[model samples]
Target: MLGLMQDWPLRLHRLIDHAARHHGARPIVSRSVEGPVHRTDYAAIHRRSLALAQRLAREGVKPGDRVATMAWNTWRHIEAWYGITGAGAIYHTLNPRLFPDQIAWILNHAESRLMFCDLSFLKLLEGLAPKLPHILRFIVLTGPETMPETSLPGAVDYESWLAEADGDFEWVAGEENAAAGLCYTSGTTGEPKGVLYSHRSNVIHALACNAPDMLGLSATDRVMPVVPMFHANGWCLPFIAPLSGASLVLPGPKLDGESLQSLMQAEGVTFTAAVPTVWLGLLQYLEASSAPLSTLKRVVIGGSACPRALTAAFERRGVHVVHAWGMTETSPIGTICGVKPEVAGRDAEGTLDLQETQGFPPFTVDMRIVGDDGAEKPWDGTTFGNLQVRGPTVTRGYFKAERDALTPDGWFETGDVATIDPAGYMHITDRTKDVIKSGGEWISSIELENLAMGHPDVAEAAVVAARHPKWDERPLLVVVPKAGREVSRDSLLAHLAPQVAKWWLPDDVVVVAEIPHTATGKILKTKLREQFAGYFGVP
Candidate 1:
């Protein structure tokens, strides 16, 4: 017999409606491309989103259709997201940093019916519009007065459409399992596969993030998510903020050190999240300018491992640093490494060490590690294995039934090799694809990369396998030094002497001007493999 419970449907529209009805005056600020700030509130967003939904429905968009957006982290983009999904259409976010061909491929593959793009991407859209046969309309997210004339003949202004519509459209009632959003993976190995998110999954993920032990969001918190909205729904902050009634500050395209710092200071932001690369820049700016990070309290770093030094630097300044881990398929938040209550009073260094792990799985997630032999390992922190997970927020399968993406047992393989301690904390060693194999022994490239990043002169580092005549394959170090800093091969290798095992040490270190990255800010190891494929060992 089922226990009686509230007949609540996890709908995306309810998030916006809740915010509008309860916290209408909360600020939603965004930086514009024209070097100015535009501010609004939950009330305005709700009204505009309703108008957008009505416009979409009037334009022949129906349930189960796909509406794509290739825009920055701005208010308009957020409206389009909720509006399209609220109208019972799937909201597909296209990463603008992807190659034009990849963008065209995703749009056509998703069979997007309409696209809303930023005005700054006019030229790029014009170049790619001809190839996107499925896209029938191109709506520029700009006002009629400022909309630039482009070669695309059928383009329309966003403000004009909103003005011509009414904010009285009712949210279409769809099943909780119905697809709400589609995000494609960066496709390091093959063509990018689509991860379809449902309204139930997205809403549940937002509620899970609101827990104090997790993201600890509140109405008083001013959040600045430097992660782009196109990237896993900005780690789901767009949905979480509205659900929690927190004030949001979107940095838009200006994610540079100085600009972000200024916005943080001006807006009195208390919590923020971004990749480690962004924090590195902000730390550099703070050090050089002697600027005080006055209002900032916590920083959540993901997309890559947070270097120990970076975490320590922020903690030294009295700021809490949380190292989270997840992928597009996990609705982006599987684990958040915050200090447990029992260890709250521990020594500073010990607590910092705990913060470096990916932390325990979030409330809605369940994690397990399986060895190469398919044996389940104990949470001893030493037994490294393939990480597999199942949760309410995790995607069961890709859009349109991609059978190979899911396992027969129903667990999603995260492609990460990791360890979980008895205390329930998880630590990722490396991606299965990036793990180095020498004489059948696995070497963690992520560990080596993190160790290399500890060196003072090393700005960033990536580790990939280089071919070896005797061992078959060994680790290769690709280093990018800080500006105007010099680090010799000997000094760099010497720094790693005491940190990692001798076998894990790189055979050679190659300094590069910059490391290539994927659209989601991950190191492009595939590119590294291609560039040094033949650099095995000398005869």
Candidate 2:
């Protein structure tokens, strides 16, 4: 039976339109890369986006063409997203932190016709311009005065280019499921694969993110995304903020603790989201400064396992911490760990233990864990297995791949080993390849890493499986001490011994000046494993 409805297409442009019409005066603040803080409103963003769309059409960008942006999380970058999508083009975001070869490969593979980059990446673009023959033009995300001289062909400043046309054209209308954005994986395992996002999926994901159980954003709230736009469309905050009429604060190139704290304090930011490393820096800064988080209310931490100590530090300051878990394939928001009423009834320590788990999924997503035999594992909180997910926002396959990236039963393999409690809370144990098998029992590297991060003297920590003659493979702990504080192997071992099984304790502890990390800020355990390949005297 067909139902009568308006049949409005779920397009990305409509999000900006709704915001402009209903919350036109809402602020979109930015710490501009050009050495000053800039501010604008949703109405101005909508109008400029439309103008940029018209300019793109004049420049011969057709529907389905890919346009790339290697910029930070600023107002201009946000405008480019709406503008490119409004012109029916795919907005491909390139992470500037990635190596030049990887960036060139991604650009060539995507066949990006044009690129909108921040001034900071001009030299990078110039170096890769030869390899990126498909990119016809380079639009620097800056004004004419601040635009630096570049040798790349057909380059221009974004503000000047956007001024070429009036915002009189309407957004292109078509199938809601058409591709609107592209984000590549961090490629820790292999060559990076693209996760193509559709307008329909993104719109649905925004609604889920704005829900109370998720980010719980509202018009009165002011939000900041320390994560960059290149990371899963800034974890969909570019859409989530406007859709909820929440004012946004975009921190430019400066992500250090002092800069972020200053911006948040100045903007009266009430909500923010980033990885644990970011918060760790901020917490350390607060510990030294004794700064009061006067207006900050909540924070969402993800991208890796957040230590419970970090959560306690925020809660101690009256700031709520929401531990979330997701990847590029799931539109980057699979599960959020907000406390449930039933779990809230427990003691404070017990509740913090539950919060340590990546919380349950929103109604749109479904999750399950499977064993090596391809059978479903019981959600008893103790048994861990391969995590799989199926949802509208989840990717069924990688872009341009010949085969589906899913199981025969149609669930996307998350590449993470996890356990789900009977109450529906999901906890990540470790990556499938990183989990240690010692004496026929599995040991969780993530668990040990998180515990190590709880130590006051530890700045960063990682656990890797080391080859052992006795157990075949045993856990090895490597840590980086906080500045000005010295950490010892014995002290770290003693701190961890009381919390976990004796066998789960690391065989040895090594202190290092620093740990290598992936472009996305995750610990590069692959490199660590290679560095300590024979740590247990096994050759």
Candidate 3:
């Protein structure tokens, strides 16, 4: 009963092809590490990517070989991304912020044969370059003038390497299920494991994110993705932006407040996406400068819960903060903060409250919360349980893992505890490991942090479990106050008393200058627990 339709497979290279054909003039702006802003177009990127593919082929890069990139978010990185995949090789984005040993370990584990890195990260990789015996060549993403001398086995300037070939080649089309990209997690829970994304999954994720009700991107928008390409495929931005024909503004190495604001002004960026900490930094810069993001409309914040104060700050400037939720395993976008049709009629205050939740699952995703006994939980928004999902873009297992990570009935257990509302909105309670147990009860660390962030003086906050004599474990409030702002423990506790159950209040408050963060900008609660595990005198 097969239908007589064309069986053409969807590949990511065709996305760039489409952009070049239709939106060739759309600009791709990058503040390259070479110290200047380089502006190119979709047509230019496509032609250059073709040259890159040809050059890779000439360099003996074979299909299914691993090609690594240790660079920032820039046009050259995008070019490498497509060229590597276009040549039917997997694109492994190496995070430079990770520990150097971890980077070396990941590169060895993936057996990466070649690498494309920015000049800035060359020194960081120098110490481990000799150890990566599998790597055949290293193409520095810079011109010959700026390329530094390195001890990498086989190194060349990218411009010279690309010049070896012209944009006179066709992309090698592989099966849709062929691995196209690889990203490892932040290893907050354990060692970083690789998640291989097929061409099909990446193509599908781009389609889903650009849907009208999702990110709702179009050709007219000027998009800027501040999230690094090394992290979760840059949340699939490198694909989605080109597919939508939107002009791009890639914020390379300088993600500081002044640098970002300057780029936004120069480029007239209309839409952007990043984690909460990034937005917090931008907002602080704006507040300090008394500036306005005139052309910016909406910002998608994820990687951590969007603080209520941060959301309100953006709203005050007539911008919308879309609270998103995802992990590296979900192809990074499971849910976004857009209202469903049923809940669209709520009042302003009610709408604000609704947006604070993680919103509903998008079209391709299926979600459910399961109780301790493995039964489906009620959708009352009050009963929290283990969140599980199954989707086309979801990974069935790690890259080389032995076992399939799925329930017997076929759902992947997301390590989050979430509650779904009757209206179908999902609210994340906390990570399984971060939830506190007190005298046979559970408390959500996310909820406590959200409430604590509402206080005026508290710039940042994290709640972790500490041993207690009677309850086995109790909550500890770790606060980082605003610069030069006085914060008393009594006031912060008073603010939380009315919002949550009295028993759920933190045992004590400790002030610190700064909080440790993961490469993705999430609070490293594991570190916090390790540092303060015995606060209540446990072994």
Candidate 4:
């Protein structure tokens, strides 16, 4: 028999409601694309969101309709998320960094009726207008003064549209399992697939990610998410900030190192999250200028592995670095590396080593690794296998796929190969397809790349499997040297000699001016493999 208790459903709108009711004056700051920083409070955000919902309803935006947005992280985009969801519609974020054809295809695939875009993408949208016939309207996210003349149909300024409503309407209520948001993968493996998120899943993910051992956020902190809103819902920071009553800062379209450092310092931001590449730029700028990040207390790095040198650099400056791991399919927050009680006694060096791992999951998510025979591997820190995960927030299937993307036993196969230590820290070795094979043994390219990044002269590093005749396959190191620094092959190899097994060493080193990357700032190894496929004279 089920226990008797309150049956109130947990919905996404309640997060905004909680912030508006209790933390009304908490600031929601943003750098506007029009050339200045703008500030608004939760109370104003709540009121404007209600106005937006009313406007949507009046325009015949029915429940379950897909509303598209192609804007940066700003106050307007944040309001659109809640407003669209409150009107019982799904918000689909279109990544501007994606190819124009892909963006058009995604818009048509999702059947988005109305779109809200920034002024910078106006020309882009105009160029793709011929390909996107299903889009009925284009609402520019700006005021009358900054709005530009556009050729798209049914175009209007956001301020004019939002001013039509007085926020007199209440949020439309529905089941917790209704679709709320849509995010597509980077399509590295194949065609981009959409991961539909439900209201219950989004709310649950925010709750789990806000725990003490997870992000550990509090109301008194100022938070910034350098990650884009169009990417995995800005890594869920939009929701986490409001749910915890933290002041949110959006960097707008200016993500350069100097701009970011200036914003963080001016706002007194204490917590922030972004990929490793962003931090590398900031560190470079700080080294050149000798600037201090006096207000930053912690930074959570993801999107790619955090180099050990990068982590140590931040720690040396008295800022904590957290290595998190997740994908669009996992609501983008499967694990966060917060220190646990059992490993608290370690010294500084040991702690940094442990922090390099992806860390364990919260109770909401489950993780495991299995070998070729479908047997669970031991948590010995050295035995690596195919990583698998399953949880309430994890996607059971793609948005419109014919079949579920799960194994016969119902676990989602993450493309990564990893090992779980005895203390439950999970460390990723390599992707299943990217792992190199020498003779019959497996070698992790990620391991070699991470070691290469520690070199003082190396600015960036990548490893790919180059075909070898004698060994079947071997690892090749590709590096981009720092400006005006001479990084020779012998010196890098000598630096890595003592720390790793001799067999795991790269067969050769190749220097390049730059490496190609995906739209999400990840190394595009497919291109690297093709470029150096015959480096060893293998047929």
Q: Model 2: which residue pairs collide?
A: none
Candidates 1 and 4 compared by lDDT, better number: 4
Clashes of 1: 0
Candidate 3 residue pairs that clash = none
Global lDDT of each candidate? 0.88, 0.92, 0.89, 0.92
Name the regions of candidate 4 deviating beyond 4 angstroms.
none
Candidate 1's C-alpha runs over 4 A off are 1-6, 402-404, 536-539
lDDT, candidate 4, equals 0.92
Query: What's the C-alpha lDDT at position 295 in model 3?
Result: 90
- Compared with the true structure, the alpha-carbon lDDT of candidate 3 equals 0.89
- Each model's TM-score, in the order given? 0.97, 0.99, 0.98, 0.99
Instruction: Estimate, for each residue in 318-381, the C-alpha lDDT of model 4 and write its tens digit.
Output: 9999999999999889899989898898999999889889999977899999997778999999
**In model 2, what lDDT does residue 253 have?**
90
- Stronger candidate by lDDT (3 vs 4): 4
> Which candidate achieves the best lDDT against the true structure?
2
Per-residue alpha-carbon lDDT of candidate 3 for residues 1-539, written as tens digits (9 for 90 to 100): 99999987888898999999999999999999987999999999999999999989988888899999999999999999999999999999988888888888889989999999998887887888878989989999999999888987788999988998977899997899999999998776667899999999999999987787789889999999999998888988889988999999999999988889899988999889998888878877997898668998889888888878888888888888888888888898999888678888888668778877988767778899998778999999899999999998888999789998899998989889999999888999899888998999999898899889999898899999999888999999999998789788899999999989999999999999999998778899999999889998885
For candidate 2, lDDT tens digit of each residue in 370-427? 9998999998999999999999999999889999898999999998999999888999
RMSD of 1: 1.6
